[model samples]
Target: MIEADRISKTYARGVYALRDLSLRIDKGDFVFLTGPSGAGKSTLLRLLLRRDVPSEGQLIVGGRNLAELTPRQVQAYRRSLGFVFQDFKLLQNKTVLQNVALVPRVLGMPPSQQQRRTFQVLKWVGLQHRMSAYPLELSGGEQQRVAIARAIVNDPVIILADEPTGNLDPDLSLEIMNLFREINARGTTVVVATHDRELIRRVGRRSVTLNHGQIAELA
Candidate 1:
């Protein structure tokens, strides 16, 4: 469902975030992206999400070229994929339900349908009881669960998570990982970028490792 061919990103001052990296992820496959800091994992994720374009080569999603897409098309393409971030980028001022409902609302979904999906996904993430709580009122793990709910509420075909377990303890991290595994088992393609070696080992899926802007290993 996703393909990157010789993709590279070079910023100003000669810093290359990614270098000639090519990878393919098929539909319903779960893959782990792992590397040290400054290893270009985040850059790769950004390219996939169209948050940043590669300075060289091609990125194709669902058979559409990301490099050639217009802004409107990029937005439309993103609607097919879900993104989770390390920081849990929830709106502090919005209630959990409202925050989870934002994307469907933007797509002009009916109120009843949006509410139904939001509640269902929040429940799946084990945060249904916290639906009315604001971000600050919840613990770190709870906030991350809310973020997960928001990502999957649309039932996107691909789920991309950048360091989704970075801030939690081992037990809590395992809980979140199990949630991701469940989603992957249900036929959603799951790609997670993380530095947690133990977690990666525990999960035991194929992993692509980036080092010095290039893919140093893949297993």
Candidate 2:
């Protein structure tokens, strides 16, 4: 669950990315964040991930106030969340299995557990056959699926995807969305930031629209 209370993010020279933004996302919920460019959707996600700090107000994720966390605790907190990006962000040279396995490997998971989790998530994303392939060898949709696989391999409590389907064709976009929905159904909170209105309408999930760095609508 996430709670943002009047949170505002201001960059150097006093440019505000978000202003007095307040929102709450409950556990086991799926929410869509839709907004125009410069509307602060991405900024909000960054704040939630502790990648950036709000210049004002408070952000509490999974019951801990983000502002109060120690550097070590911030690292630990991020382990409970997953992030997918508009760009796949896969290592060009790493094989599919290795890419998905990196998170657990860094966390000091045993080799056996890492292998098992890597295979399981790749299978979940329908990429079991491509585990040995490199990122360049896979199609765009396939690469994106691998990214999703990597994101979920840790069994994160929440998944935050920013324009997850931006590079795929319509069918593939829907496929990716369905995968997120399936993940949500399994009790992981999912929040996606996208500009694709038709996709938003098609999915029919609760959507919060931002305009000028504020919540313009929530439906």
Worst 10 residues of 1 by lDDT: 203-212
Give Cα distance to truth, residue 26, candidate 2, Å.
Answer: 0.2
**lDDT of candidate 2 over 1-219, digit per residue (tens):** 799999999998999999999999999899999999999999999998899889999999988999899999999999999999999999988999999999999999999999999999999999999999999999999999999999999999999999999999899999999999999999999999999999988888999999888999999
lDDT, candidate 1, 1-219, per-residue tens: 999999999999979999899999999999999999999999999998999899999999899989899999998988988999999999999999999999899988999999999999999998899989999999989999999999998889999999999989988888998989999999999999999989999988889999988999999
CA shift of 79, model 2, Å: 0.5
The whole-model lDDT of each prediction reads 0.93, 0.94
TM-score (all chains, Cα) for each model: 0.98, 0.99
Query: Model 2 clash pairs?
Result: none
Q: Which stretches of candidate 2 lie over 4 Å from their true place?
A: none
Best-fitting candidate, measured by lDDT?
2
| lDDT, residue 139, model 2 | 93
